[model samples]
Every structure is written in structure tokens, then in C-alpha cells.
Target: MSAKRMQLFAFFISVTLIWGCQLEEQEFIPDVSGIEAEVDIRRFDQALFQLDTNDMQPELQKLMEAYPELSTLYFTHILRANDPRTAPDGPAPYVKGFLQHESVRNLYDSVQVHYPNMSDIEAELEQAFRFFQYYFPDEPVPNVSTLISEYAIAAFVYGENDLGISLDYFLGQDYPYQKLNPRDPAFSAYLTRTFNREHLTSKAIQTLINGLVPPARQQRLLDLMVNNGKKLYILDKLLPYAPDSIKLEVTGPQAEWLEDNELEMWAFLIKEDLMYETDNRKIRKLVDYSPHSPGMPEEAPGRTANWVGWQIIRAYMEKHPETTMQELIALEDAQGLLDASRYKPGR
Candidate 1:
């Protein structure tokens, strides 16, 4: 086998390594383990079990009367409080992790041991959230991933930096950065910094969405959004609500250029949505403050809909189920997907 094939083989095994570890169980807590990490699990899960949820579900229903996020908010916070160590890096990527070891099996195993109401309630809530695509957007997420191309997903969601994970990378180990530093007083202080929670500002909403959905689901979800029309998501317009901390400028010609290519449009939108909060400034800034993330200098692939290339490859795989794992993984990147010639950027 070739070098690329070896990597694919490793990735497949890597995925298989996590089974009993339900990464999605990350209702809270950081992704990393082995460092008194399991304590967060015990404290947080038990704390939730002890909450005064007395007939609160229906009352809680009043707030979320509209969407699952409404309900997810209160519950996740309950989890966040007890598991005070994740942030900046966020917890969604960990959510996609497999239950690699049995350390936390007892956490789930004991769900019924204490809070019998939880065993079913947790699954019920996740089920309700399954209908929409959840990703990171400045707005309250609709259940899709904002990490468009595999790059963002790989780093932010999959926990792997294409540049390779480094201590220098500010994101801070992606998953553990989210769980907060158990050694810091700031973790407790930072948890309460949400004075603006109720208003549900663009930034807050995006944070919640990422916390709710896993990267694996988000990846498949990028497909769902593209399959749904590549451009009709009504939420796209509301993203400007986020503060202008991040900025960019996309000239009209670029917009028009992108308009002609729906696939590019799809890819661009997903790409932009993924970076709603970052300041890297690599993507083309189509709107004020918000730019096509993965920020760069000028013309990049698919201005509006970046997910198109990814989806096309997915479509191909669906049609050709016989394709090898190596073949499929090779088509995972932005350039790889585009080079397939299926996506004609600025066409």
C-alpha cells in the first residue's frame, strides 16, 4: 500500500478506537481525559441529577416553546456549571469522539441509579434536536455545523490541526480548551460571564450550537444544508448580529462572480458561517465584520457555498459505494474536492 493509503488505514482505525466513549455524551466537560478529567464527569453529571427539576420540564417548555435550543440552553448550562473546565476551544469536537475507554461508562451506567428521569430525557432531547443542521453561526444554531470544508472541521471539530496539533496553536488542544483549566480561578469566573445569555446575542447563540452538535454530525450536516438548496437558509442573513470584532471586504465583482456558481455559493456560505467568531481574517469578507473564514488575502474557492465540493464528492461516493476508503479520504479536502472538476468556482 502507498503512504496515502496508510494514512487512510490509520484514520479508519482511529475512528474505530473510540466506541464505548460516546463523545456526544459531552453535554459538558472537556475532550481530554487522564488528568483528573474524569472528576468533571462525576461532579457535573451528579450535579445535574440533583437539580430542582421538579415539574420544570413543562415550565421549561414555555421558554423553548419554539426550538430545542431553548430547552438545550438551561440543561447544558446545568452541565457546564458542574464541569467547569472547557471554553475557547469549545466542546463540540469532543462530542464526536468515540467512547474509546471504559472510564466514563459508569457515568452513563449510573444515570438511572440516581436520576431516573434523566435516562430517557437526555435521549429525548437529543432526538428533538436531530431535525435541523447544527453548526457554528453568529445566530442561534439550527442544528448544523459551521465548519464547512474539512479544514475547520478537522481542527475545530475533529480535534486535528492539519498543520498538526501544537502547543503554539492558540485554540489550545481544541477540546480541552473548552473544558477550562481545572487549575484556574478564571474557569469559575468565565462561566458566569454570560450576563448576556438571555438576549441571545449572535456570539452566544453560535457557542450554544457548537456545544450541542458533534463534528461528525456536523460533517454529514454540511451535506444536508447543501442538499437542502445550497442557498435558501433564512438564518444566513441574521449572522451579522455578531459584533464587528472580525472583519473583511468582498467586492461586488466577487459576489457576482460567486452568484453564477451555486456550488461555490454553497461552499462559501458554509465557510463563512464556520468562522462567525474567529479573527484570522483568511476568508473573503462578504459582509461587514463577517468574512469567508479561514481568512486569506483574496479570491478563494467557492465564495458563497463552499460545501458544494464536499457534497459532490459525497454524492459520488453514494453512487459508487465500491470506492475504497483511501479513495474517499483523498477527496476529503477543499482542493481535492474541487480538483475533481465537479466544482467550477466563479463559474
Candidate 2:
């Protein structure tokens, strides 16, 4: 062959190889249309806010009857108010007081304006749950509800089959979370940046994962990382359409930083021998919610180790496509999983 033709042939082969790798990395979107799942997000915030303060007794009774478990949970846990069923005066006084509070009312109004309808969120969750049913057909789908919890809880799974979302906590990034009285340090800019509609479905599915997945047997850094990785992998399966930034709970730049530094981070962990370390404080530095991971560069996002573990699990799954999610979760040996994963970064 002529020299020019040979170079062109080589270039074409290289292009084909790169394209093949990209296709392999693309998310595996399963056909979930055949899976039947329904998600109707009951607007508890509207019902509570629209109560008849002048004559709240009858309406409160109706609310209690309608949302038996959720109303009790709201009063007892979210609001810290006396349970209406057991209280001497019932929840009328407390409900009335809460409804009349200027700050609470303002918060509710903002929630309504931001989320005039939960149809979009409901549809996203329904799709996620359909994936859930596709993976685990025997598990019952939870009944979903939305509420404004005065910033107490973001998302929670209660009583085995109920999932609740606190809408006020997700009032977008532009909301003045810092201006609220008794400001919480947890509401820092880095954290609250994710407090928007884009993350609602991921957060809800994460809540369900927490409820379903068993806790790690050991407290070693590797165990925690692998445990969190299992959850993230399952989350990836459930939310195939969500970006890695949303799934990892990191900003776009942060996600890019992690991806770019994957090999460096892995080397750092191995050289320092930090994975088997079981100290809670050290583990928290690598896995907890924070601006950046300690002992790493400032650009490294918190939960760095968890992201590494997720990659390991991904590699392992790719290596063994037949391994089921249940089997992966039940495989408690973190070290074993890592060895089987053969996860060499930048390969």
C-alpha cells in the first residue's frame, strides 16, 4: 500500500477504537416502559396551609383521617408539635399557631410559587420507580408525598412503604437560605446549590436506597466507600438519565475535577494505605459532606472515596455482567470486591 493510504488506514482504525470506547461508556438505558409503576405526589403542604384557622377542628380531623401516618409524622417529628390524636387540646392550637407564623407562611408561599405543580417531579419519580420495579419486582413501590417541613428534613422514607419530600428545602439555589433566622451552617452555598428541582428525583430515590440497602458491616474506610458505592451504583441503575454530577451530589466542575484526578486519587489512597483504616474521623474526612476532601487537593470534592468505590463497582459489574444487584449488595467483602474489580484508572 502507498504510505499516505497506510497512514489514513491507521487513523481510521484509531477513530473506530475511540468511538467503540465511548459507546461502551454510554449509560445502559433499560426498557422500563413495560414496568408498571405509579407515583402520585400528594401535596400535604397545600392542604395544611389552606386549613380553616377560624374553624380548624373539623378540617384537622379530616386531614388526620386522610393522611393517617404522614399527618402523625408531620406533627410528631417534622413540626415537633403534640400529636393531635393524643393531645388534650388536639393539634388545633399548634396547627393554627404554625399556620399563622409569618416566616412559615412566607416559606410556604415560596414553595407554592416555585412548585405550582409537582407533575414534573411526579413523572420523573414514576420513571425511576419503574426502573426500580424492573430491577426488584417483588418490592412494593412506596406511596409518595410532598410537604414543607420548615427545613427539618429534605427527603425521608417512613413505615416501610411511604416516602416524603420536604419541598421547602428544595426551593432552588436563588432562595435566601442564609437569611432565615437561626441559620444552619449545613445550608452553606456548596450544599444548597443542589437544592433545586433537578436533584429532586435523585434525592427521593436515594432515600429509598437508604431504606432498602443494608448498612455496611464494618467501619473501615474501604467498607464505607464500597457500601456507598453500592448505593450509587444502584442509583445509577435507577436514574440512568441523571448526570454523574447530580448522582454524586457535586457541581459540574467538581465532577470534572474528580474524573480528571481519578488515577491520582487512587494512587494517593493506595500509597497512604488509607482504605483499610477504620478510624471514624479519618473516614469522615474522605466520605462525609463537606466542601472538599481532607488530605487531598482543595479541588477534590467531599465523598471522594465513595466516588472511587463507585468506579470500582462499575468496573466489577462490567467485568461480570451476570452479577445481579442483590448479589453485589449481599457481597459484604469490600476487599474481595475491590480485588475482583481490577479497576485500574486511566486504562
Candidate 3:
């Protein structure tokens, strides 16, 4: 037989095999590429607002097309343009192949806060979630107790004196929505009630990122991560504060770890169910590492008065015993916060 003829025969066989292979449809997983969840909602929202959605990067466009789960990037671009300068009336002002859902577009304007605030980001995220809801309403809503646990986890990471939003906002609500629970474990309620769904997803992702998810609600997630051992936590804002190694749901034969630190802590902290203690930890941890002890500072430009001051106030109260939580939180000794090392242990 001629060599060219043999090559042609081989090529036809290869084409036949390629055409004969059956490909399974991939399950829908939320898209969260290149986004960090630990960021205060404001900054996260700001970042979204800043991306030049009009950019003609072919790869980024391909990424978006192949990974619609990350549609949040487009949303962020729309959010930036939502302003009068960009959109005199509304978002999606003139863009084609863009989405501008009501949940995100009409998310009420945010208040100007001096400290890190999570509300704007949270609200906008909730609005963003409407897309997910549109995509998967039948998928189970995250457990409320699970949500609270995750919220608490995020609050702890935010630390004291951060202008950033924390779980306290929800616990203080006058009217909380229906409480939801996971079906597994003992089938007990995770959150007594759910005041907000955006908060729910945010906290859940935060907890997962921080290794703080509650055990009852985490079993299925853990099992999935263990089996597949791929990327686990979902919040882009919270990812910056967390370590790189995460617990992902297992599938397609992957290596698994015994536990995911961020995820485990989220569950442990939630099951403990002590907001005040969690708050105390939030304040204390910030002070311990942020400025007082000076192990690391999260904000790059170095905002000095955040967690350090709150830690001093909380420590003073813990030592004094009679200090009220409100008074402690409201304390205004900027110098004292800066000089937290004076009160550490022996001082």
C-alpha cells in the first residue's frame, strides 16, 4: 500500500473515533473566576464599576462566553456605568449582549461611610444574585443558619472599627425574613430567620473562604470537595483575606485533603452561635495582627486606625469587666488605638 494512502486511511479512522465519542453535559457551577470575595462590598463594587466593559480583549470575552458563571464581571462593569455620567437614566445604557437585572440596577444608593462598609456591595451582590436565581430558582436556597454562621465569619474577618459591613447589620434587623435550614444532619434550623438573601450567599462564601462553615450544613459541601478536591469557596470579596488552598467539590477523580481550613472554621464558628463572642474575636484578631502586634496589615496603603483601636477598646472592657459593649464600640481614643502595644499583656 502507498504511504499517502495509508495516512489517509488512518486520518479517516481518527475522524470516525472523534465523531463517535459521547460527551456528557457539564453540571452548572457558579462562575467566580479572578474575583476575590473578602473585599469590603464597596471596594468589590468599586472594582466592578471600574472594569472597562467596552474593552475588546478577545481572551476575556472568550472566558466570559465559556464561563458565564462569572457574569458578575459584566455586572460590575454595568454597575460602574449605572451612574448619571455613564447612564443618565439606567444601566445597560447602550451595550449589547449585556444584562441589567432589576435586583442589581435599582439596588438603592449607598450612604457615604468613613469606615469600610459592606452594605453597598452586599445590596449590589444581592441584585447580582437575581441572575443566579433566574438561572437556578429550583436549586436549594442556602440554609439560613448556614447564612448566619457565614455572616459571623465575615464579620470576624472584617475585625473591629472597619467601615466594612459585618453580620451585626442583619442581627439588628427589625423584620427578618423566613428562617431556613439544611435538610441534612439533625435537620435543625441554621438561621432563625433570613432577613436578606444576598447576605446569605455572601456570608456562606465568606465562611467557606475562612474555613468557618457550620458542620450541619457543610456535610454535603465537604463530601463534594473531598471527592473532587477542587475550588470550594464562592465569594470573590472574601477570597483576598483567605489563604489560597480551598476545599472544592470532588468530581472527575481529583486529590482530596482531610479538611479545608477556611471552610472548617466557618462551620465551627457558626455552630458555636455566639455573636458577641464572635464579635469579640473579630475585634481582638484585628488588633492582634493588624496594628497592635504588627504581624500584618490587610489594607495596603496602611489605614492605621481600624482593628487596632477596636481591639484596645474591647481589651480595656475585658480587663475592666464593667465596660458596656455599646460604649466600648463607640469609644474614641484614636491615640490609644495607635498605641495598642502599651496594653498588650504586661503593659
Global Cα RMSD, each model = 20.1, 8.9, 26.6
Name the runs in model 2 displaced over 4 angstroms: 1-26, 83-90, 181-183
Worst 10 residues of 1 by lDDT: 160-169
**Model 1, 192-249: lDDT tens per residue?**
2321212222232233333332232223323332322112211122232222211011
- Candidate with better TM-score, 1 vs 3: 1
**Best-matching candidate per lDDT:** 2
> In candidate 2, what residue range of length 10 has the lowest lDDT sum?
15-24
Tens digit of per-residue lDDT, candidate 3, span 77-165 = 32343356765654444332222334223221211122135455454444434332433344332211101122222232222112223
lDDT of 2: 0.83
TM-score, one value per model: 0.24, 0.89, 0.21
lDDT assessment of candidate 1: 0.30
lDDT of 1 at 249: 18
Better of 1 and 2 by TM-score: 2
- Model 3's C-alpha root-mean-square deviation from the true structure amounts to 26.6
Alpha carbon lDDT of each predicted model: 0.30, 0.83, 0.30
TM-score of 2: 0.89
- With a 3 Å backbone cut-off (N, CA, C), the pairs that clash in candidate 2 are none
